[model samples]
Every structure is written in structure tokens, then in C-alpha cells.
Target: MLMLLWNVLKKFDLLSLDNEEEIISHLRRLSDDENYLLRDIIQAYQILQDCFQNITYQHLQLVKTVVEYSNVIEMMKKSDLYSTYGRRRFQELRDNLTTQFQLQE
Candidate 1:
């Protein structure tokens, strides 16, 4: 669903073609997940796209932030130590840092 929306947006020049593959790649793994989280992430992406339109500098940074954080989260979830409280704390810190970067622009 997210990929289709992204492709539609890209085809219509509403989104960048350069980042289209990267966005789809980032989203491909969760394509089959029967959960709402992926949809929420795409919604967040769209929100950022709308809210930060015309701010290319910040927009790229936003995409990078989300992709990197999502990758980390995915790795943590698949790792043996993911259930540990310390990993959760680390994720919280990482999220805070990402938020700080987003807030800066």
C-alpha cells in the first residue's frame, strides 16, 4: 500500500524519483506484515512531506533519519538481546537523537 502510494506520488511528480527506490527498499520488508505500524510510518512520511514541502535540505534529512532508525529498529527486533531492558533504553536514546536532528531543521 505504501509502495503504491509512493509510486503514485512519484509518477505524478509529487515525490522525488531519486529517492523512490530507496523508499521502496526501506518499505519492502514490511510489505507483508499484517500490522498497522508500517502504515503509520508511511503516514508519518507523508506528513513530513506535506509539512516540510519546499525544504529539500530538511526533507532529505528526514528521509535519512526515518530509514536509518527503521533499520536499527528492525535489527534490534530480530536480535537475541532485543528483549532486554537495556536495548529498549538504547532505542529510546536513539529515537531522541533522531528527534533532535529533525527538530534542528
Candidate 2:
């Protein structure tokens, strides 16, 4: 899941993209939802990836990434990343999510 998200981010150049606010807003909406499923997490990740294609400020992007990453973590807790790819993938995914979130700052 993390690798997929990272690839999408890299392929889409979401780091320098604009629409940070929109991405953040969408993330907030997803995160706030009580029934957030893995599918929603994937979709939110895609929306964020799409936003990164635009030329946005690094700070805003970081902020958005943090929220999105938080949602990923939360969802992982609910859905169990353990079943996804064992501990190694989970760690890598967590690290990547943190890296992307921090890159915004």
C-alpha cells in the first residue's frame, strides 16, 4: 500500500503540485468519516496524488501529507496492515508515509 502510494506520488509529481487545500480538505473528510474503509484510504491517497501534480507550496503539501498519512495509519490500525504484507512492508509503508508527510514541512 505504501509503495503503491509512493509510486503514485512520484509518477504524479505530487510533491510540487498545487491544490494542497483541496487535497487536505478531502483527507479531512475521509479521516473524519466513522466508517472509513481501506478503499476510502486508497481513494484519498489517489486524490492526494492527483493534487501533487499541481505546483503547490511545500508547506501546504506537507500539511496535507501529514493528515493523509495520519489517515493511513488510522486505517491500518482498523484494517490491520499485518494482513497486507507482513511486518516489513508495514514498516516500509509507515516510514514512507512519514517521509511524505514530513516532506511537506
Query: lDDT scores for all predictions?
Result: 0.59, 0.63
Candidate 1 is scored at a TM of 0.27
Worst 10 residues of 1 by lDDT: 4-13
Q: Please state the error at residue 9 of candidate 2 in Å.
A: 15
TM-score of each: 0.27, 0.27
Alpha carbon RMSD to native, model 1: 16.2
* Cα deviation of 69, candidate 1, in Å: 36
- Tens-digit per-residue lDDT, 12-44, candidate 2: 456444665665565666656768888888877
Instruction: Write down the lDDT that model 2 would get.
Output: 0.63
